[model samples]
Structures are given as structure tokens and as C-alpha cells.
Target chain A: MRIILVGSDKLTYFLGRRFTSKGDYLTIITPEEEAAVDLSRRLKATVIAGDGSDPTVLQEAGAYQADVLLALTDRDQDNLIACQIAQDRYGVPQTVAIVNDPDNKAIFEELGVSVAFSATEIIGSMIEQQTASEEIRNLVPVAGSGVTMTEVVLGPNSPAIGRAIKDLDLQGAVVACVVRRGRVLIAKRRSYLHEADRLLVISEDDQYGQAQKVLTGEGA
Target chain B: MVSNLIGGNSSASKYIVVIGCGRLGSLLAGRLSAEGNSVVVIDQKESAFENLSSEFSGFQIVGDASEMATLKKAKLDKADCLLVVTREDNVNLMVAQIGRIFFETPVVLARVFDPAREAIYREFDIDTISPTQLSADSFMQKLNTHQVSTSAPTEGVA
Candidate 1:
């Protein structure tokens, strides 16, 4: 496949080296003269020194014929714009970007980019997997922007314990599912919260604080 | 005019938020406030507000526009119109997108140095002013006019 890389980061360099070694058509665009020269020498790919966000620079780098365009620029906007230009103008089959802000991946996806990879999302999920917190566990953020589903275990001394779900002020959050004593329980308004009950709640990003306050009652 | 564009019929002041308190942002905020509109100017650097006119009665916020919390503090969701004039194109684009898409502000505009980067804004139906393109066009037009009027070869230093 004819692949185009729009930045000189480690990921781009690694991909460029691998593609060249395998004899695939590869091109790289970077704004640094020394980095372009070095990449060209080491990776044997056509390297252009200019802002990759510019359509003219991409045109000069033969973006029209690229089968895949990877916008790995450090800035999320640059990456998004570069991928957009490749997809909209050049009609590249595949367009991907590396987003700096995890929240922007959803926006990029909505804008029609094939995919967006965010380091923050990856690292955040990794940390979530590794965390040993007894109250909150495996909080997997969903869709990158607004909502996340997580497991929260209420302690014996918590305020929500023994209270009906309807009584809790969980206006901004949802108690989607609940597990108690190795059996799945129906999560309804009348359902009662018990000590050590594992609740699967989905809440918006900004309302996580309110959801935590409602469930844990620590903000009292 | 701001109230009209913001879908409000009230003759009262409309809310305008300007991100980046640089020269252009400060001037805009000052002018809007002088017009009796409620304005808020935000910048990461507190010193940037020194450029604002003393007569300006708008609120000043010192924080990064890239953060959601900062934008919330600035009440961006309640803004009738938002102007993003940050030096970085990415920050401006992101903030403008949020103002337009998330907050559904009536008017969202930004200053982009790279004319090429304006395509993304155009795709999202956001407005952008490219100072680089505007200045270059004006300068080139003046240069051409001067050249056409001074085509005579100098015979001697008179």
C-alpha cells in the first residue's frame, strides 16, 4: 500500500522504517529539515519538509495516490486537518490521526476520520486496569468524550447503603446494572443499595463528581 | 445586532466571550463592552490583560481556553457569540468547535494564520479570518499598483 506519514514522531519513524524494509511505497512529511534528511537517509522514503497540514505540501508529497494517510502530528487540530484534507480532497481510502486530547477523538470520528488513536485514552485505560482501588474498579471510558461505565462498590459505612435507589440524588448518572452476592440484581428505582454491592453505573464526564458524591457520600 | 444574531429580541446586552486577550482580542472586547454588551475576555497570561483598555468594563479571566473547566468558568455555553484568536491554530480550532458544536453558540469565529487550516473550519461551518491572506492580498495589490505607476527606467539620479 502507498502510505503517507505526516509527522516525524517515533511512531511515524517506526512505521516508515518497517514499511520501507518490507518494500512498500512510503512517504513522510515533516517541517524540520534535519529530521526530514535523517528520515530520508535511514528509512529510504520520500521525505518532504513542510507543514503537513497544508494541502499544497501534501500534494507535493503525492497524497493523491496514497492508499493510507496517517496524521501523527503532535497537535490534534493539525492531525485532524491533515487527515481531512487527504480524505476529502485526495479521496484516500484510509485516513487516521493521533489525537493528543482523548476527548477530541469523538469529534474527529464525527468529522468522518476513519479512526483516531489517542495516547491519553490508551494510558488511561492501562492505569484503570492496573489500579487497586477497592471502591472503583475497571472504569472504562466509553466513546472518548462524555460518558464512562464503571464498577463502584459501596462500603458498609456509606450513606447510600440500605437506601433505595430512588432516594439517592442520582439525577446526572444512571445505575445501569448491579451485582450483589454473586447474583445479578435488577437495577430499578425501588432497588435497595446494600453494603459491598457492585454497581455498574454510567455517567457523563463532568457529572462523575456528582455520581461519586451520590454513591460514596464522601462529599458530605 | 448581537442580540439579533443570537436569536434574542431583547434590547438588553448580549453576552460575548473572547478567547486570548492579545492585541486583537483586547481591542475586540473593549469595543464590544463599549457598545454596552456584556463581554468576557480570557487568556492564560494575566499580563495580557494589561493591553486591554481601562475603559473596558468586561470581565477578565486568566486561564487556558483549552481546558473545559476554564471554558465553563468563562460561561462559554451561555455566550451568544465567541471569538477565538489564540496564536495556536489547534487551540483556536478546538475551542471554536466546542463553542459551535457543544454549546451551540450563534456565532463562532477564529483567526487562523494558515489559510490551509481554514478548510477544517469551513467543513464544520465555522467562520475564520486569515490575517495572513488578507494582509498578503492588500500588500500585493499595493505593490502592483506602485510598480505599474513607476515603470519608467531611471536615466540618471536626478
Candidate 2:
């Protein structure tokens, strides 16, 4: 996937690194030359020094062909404007914006922009998960929201992985997505899971323990 | 000779270097400096110092804290503590990890934006603060206290 990220800050750089490592083409746009230079060097992604809110800059960065455009600038207005330009002018299929101000998240969503409240929702969910259980490795909300989906990579000794999804007996959780050796498999009852395969599960707040037990095979 | 050595050591105050001088970094530096501990701040952006306390009497360097050269320049090995308060949680984590794992600094604290990433930071066994979660809780508290005023008058008032 071709991903264009606006801003060269730490979050943008982190995402750029993650996406680039996954074989996704990434281009980062930053107004500051130092940020662009630093992030470009760190992530080894194409860094364009220009105003992300400008259409000309977006064109130069190949925003039109981008599969996903992330407007992650520090300023909320800049992110919104960038998202608008990417969606409206460039005709990008998927555009996600980071809403620094949680209050403006609704406005961005209303405009049909996928919004990630990094400072609020993302961190809030993680804090909730941390308080819930220690076994949760990394909890990333897919598509940046809803259903509270998380990816859990089973440990080597985990008892649940060898067992089929149905045999794991997940009481209140549903496996939504699974990734085995770069192959994405939608969760199914018949899916015979493996030890190293990454699993994406969605469950209620109360069911987190059961979900963790099923994922980690702690109970088994 | 013993009296001269004791007098010389008593005059030297403990110094701390804070890397990634953002909001939390600046705050910690300011607080520590105010308490008479010598402080030095290092940040990639030179403009970040604008928010720093004027009363803080400390050296400020504009450079990446992750770089070994920068760390050496900041005197990490000699500093009593290294505080990593960059906005990027990863950078802060890396800085803290290096301070603890490499330099074996006595104290290392990092600012972590994602509370979920705390486990990873804990694996490194360094202190961490999640500013984002605190901000969210503050917002939630404000929302709970928010009151809506209706057009209707009170029972005793017109």
C-alpha cells in the first residue's frame, strides 16, 4: 500500500517506520527541513519538505496514487485541511487524520474523514488494556476505532495456539482477524491457529480476561 | 588535604540532563533547577526553549538525544539522572533504555504517550509517565462537571 504521511514528528515517523517495514510505500511531508531530514533518515521513507495542506505539495508527494493518506500534523486545522485536500482533490480512497484536540474529532468524522484521536482514544484504550491485564502485548484499534479490536501474537508456550479457534472456547470474545506469515486470514471457527500467528480479537471490557486467557492459553 | 577535598566536593551540586525538552521535559527541568540541582536540557528543536522557565539556570543544547555524540556532549555518564521527555514515546523509551542499559544511569524517566506502550517501557525497567492518558482523564473530568443552563427561571427567581 502507498501511504502518505503528513508531518515528520515522532508519531508520523513511527507509523512511517512500521508501514515501510511492512513493505508499504511511504512518503512523509513536513514543513520543517530538520524534521524532514531527521525522519527521512530514520524511517528511510521518501520525505518531501513542503506544506502538507497545500495541494501542490500533495501532488509532488504522489498523494493521488496513495492508498492511505495520514494527516498527522500537530495542528488540528492543518490535519483537517490536508485530509480534505487528499479526499476531495486527490480522490484518495482512505484518509486518516490525527485529531490532537478530541473535541474536533466529531467534526472530522462528520466530514467523512477517518480520525484517530491519538492523544485521547488511542492512549485511553491502551491505558485501559494495561490496567486490565499484563499479558496484552500490543493493542492497536484497527481502522483507528470501534469494536475495540486488538492484535495479539501468541507466545511460544501458549496453549491456545495449537488448538482450533473453536476448541479454545473463547467465552465472550470473537477473533476478527488473523495474520500468519504475512497472510491475512479472517477469523473463523474452523481456523486452526498456530503458535506464532498474530490474532486480532474483539471483546467487551468485561471479557478482556477471557480473551487474554484464550489468546495466551494461560487457563489451558 | 582531607579538609581541602571535603570543601571542594561540598561546593559541587548534582547535575541532571533532561533530553527532549518538550512540556514535561521543561517542567521537570524547571522544577529540579528551582530546587538548586544543576540541570542541562537537550532538544532537537532550538525553539522548544521558549517555553522553559526563565529562572532555570541551566545549559540548553539543541541536538538529538538519541545520538551517542549528543549524549556524550550532554555528559550522560556524569549526570545524576537523565529524563527523556520527548513527545515521541518511542524516542523517549529508546533514550531511557540507552541510559539504563548502556550507561547504567542511576535514574531514568521517560514520557510515554500511549499507556499501552507502558509494558514495553516496563520491560526496560525505567520510570514512565503517560501524558496522553492524563490529558484524557482531565478532559473527561471537565466533561463530567460541565453544566447546561436552561432558559427556565429558578423556583424563587423571576
Candidate 3:
């Protein structure tokens, strides 16, 4: 796929190497000439040194042929404009941007960016999951799928400790698997939950809270 | 045309928010303030405010125009008009969009350096000024007039 990346940071280099290794055509636009030269030498991709948000620069970077555009600039405004121009003018199918300010994520989405992610929000959510409780160990969101995988450890007082997987009242979630004493077991209908068993639940993103409540008898 | 868009001649105290205290922004804010209108100028750098004259009676805000926090602090909702003249075309476009779409400000004007980006601003019904295009057109007209006068004298001699 033809990919256009805006901004030249560590993330840019990582993505450039991964995509080029996969034989995908990559074009990188950055404002720093030195960084562009370094990136061109390191990665098998075209690098152009210019303002990524400028329409002329984007045109020169072959935005028209881009299957996806990723705007990872530090400035949210520049990232937003680069994505906007790539989508609106170049007819790129998908555009993603990194919002420096978490508050601007919604605004970027409202303005028609395909995906707008904030690093701070992601890190904050990870921290929240770590400090949430002993029972809930982790929450991993499946990007673009609207699904989440939550790892819940059953404690002595867990509501599902004595019940079978089929008996648990899950709204839109299912017990995908269970780990008991380091043994991975595929969850079956008659699989009985036990204390110290780690249940990996896959559920719709919005229904995770209800799923958590059903297993722990406490709201997420 | 720009002054007319802001309702130039009328003597009413209209609250205005001017983004970017650069040359154009400072000049516009000063003129509006002198005309008895309440004006507020916002810029990312405080030093940009030094361009404003002492006679300019208006509030100054040092913050990014593209951020919603800065716009809220400037009370953009209370403004009768918004003027954006930041150096970056994208910054000017973003700020003007926030003012026009989010706050639904009645009058929004932004100066876009790149003439190619003017269409997007006009699509949203925001007034945009392209200095490069404007100056180029003005220069072309002057060159044409000079040619006409010079050719007339040559024609008379012939």
C-alpha cells in the first residue's frame, strides 16, 4: 500500500522501517532537512523535507497515490491540517493523526479525521488499568474492531468463583479462556470458575463494564 | 473590503477577538479600538503584543489560537467578530474554523498565505484574505496601466 507519513520523529523511523521491510511503498514528509537525509539513508522510502501541512508539499510527496496518511507531528494543528488536506484534496482513503492535547481528540474526529489518538490518554488508561483493582489485571482494546479483551483474576469473594461459564450473566461478553495455576484452558460451556483462575473475557468495548460487574459483583 | 465586512462605518461598540498580534493583527486591533470597539488580541508569544501602540486600548492574551482553551479564555463566544492573521496558514485556518463552527461567531475573517487553501475557508463561509494573490493582482494591474501609457506615446510617434 502507498503510505505517507508526516513528521520525522522516532515513531516515524520505526514505522518507516516496518513498512519498508514489508515492501510497502512509503513516502515521508518532514520539516527538517537533516532528518530527511538521515531517514532516506536508513529506510528504503522517499523522504521530502518540507512543511507537511502545506498542500504543495503534500502534492510533491504524492499524496494522491497514498492509501493512508499518518500525521504524527508534535503540533496538533499541523497534524490535523496535514490529515485534512490529504483526505479532502488528495482523496486518501484513511487518515490518522496524533493529538498532543488529549482534549483535541474529539475535535479531530468531529472534523472527519479517520482516527485521532492521544498518547497521554493511552498511557493514562494503561495506568488506570494497573491501579484499578487486584481482580482486573489488564484491558486491551482491539483497534477498529470495537472490542476489548479484559483479563480478570477471580478472587475468593468473586461472584463467578463457584459458577460455570454458561451460568454467568454476561450482557455482550464471553469468557474466551481461563488460566488456572499457569495452565491455559479454552473456556467451555461447563467450565467451572475457581479462585485464582484468570479469566480472559472478550466483549464489546462498551459492555466491558457490565461484564466486569457480572464477574466481580462490582462495577468497573 | 475587509473593514466593510466588519461593519466599518457604524459607531457601535462591538466586541472583537483578534488572533495573532503580528503586523496585520495589531494594526486591525488598534484601528478597531480607536473606533470605540472593544478588542482582544491573542498570540502565542507575548512579544507580538509589543507591535500594538500605546494608544491601543484593548486586552492582550498570550496563548495559542488553535487551542480551545485559549479561545475560551478570550471569550470568543462573546465576540461580534473574529479576525485571524497568524503566520501559519494552517493555524489561521484552524482558529477561524473553531470560531465559526464551534462558537458560531457571526463574522469570521482569516488571512491565508497560500491561495490554494482559500477555497476551504470560503467553503465554510469564512472570509479569507490572500496577501500574495492580492499583491500580485495589484502589481499586474499597475504593470498593465504603465504599458498602456507607454504604448500610447509610442503609437503617437509612429
Best by DockQ: 3
Off by over 4 Å in 1: A127-220, B1-11, B140-158
Error of 2 at B81 (Å): 1.5
lDDT of 2 by residue, A109-145 (tens): 7655765565787789988767544445546544533
After superposition, which runs of candidate 3 have C-alpha atoms over 4 Å from their true positions?
A133-220, B154-158
The digit string of per-residue lDDT tens for model 3 on B1-158 reads: 65677677685688999998889999998988888889999998999999997768999999988789999999999989999999988888878878887888999989998888887557657689999989999999999999998877565365
- Residues A9-92, model 1: lDDT tens digits: 788899888988898899999989999999888888899999887889888989889999999988777887788778878888
Please compute DockQ, using alpha carbons, for every candidate against the native two-chain complex: 0.20, 0.01, 0.46
The best candidate in terms of TM-score: 3
Question: Which pairs of residues have clashing backbones in candidate 1?
Answer: none
Model 3, span A88-117: residue lDDT tens = 888999999999988789988988799999
Candidate 1, after superposition: displacement of residue B3 in Å?
A: 10
TM-score of 3: 0.76
- Scanning candidate 3 chain B in windows of ten residues, the lowest lDDT window is B149-158
Task: Pick the winner on TM-score between candidates 2 and 3.
Answer: 3
In angstroms, the error of model 3 at B95 is 0.7
Which one wins on lDDT? 3
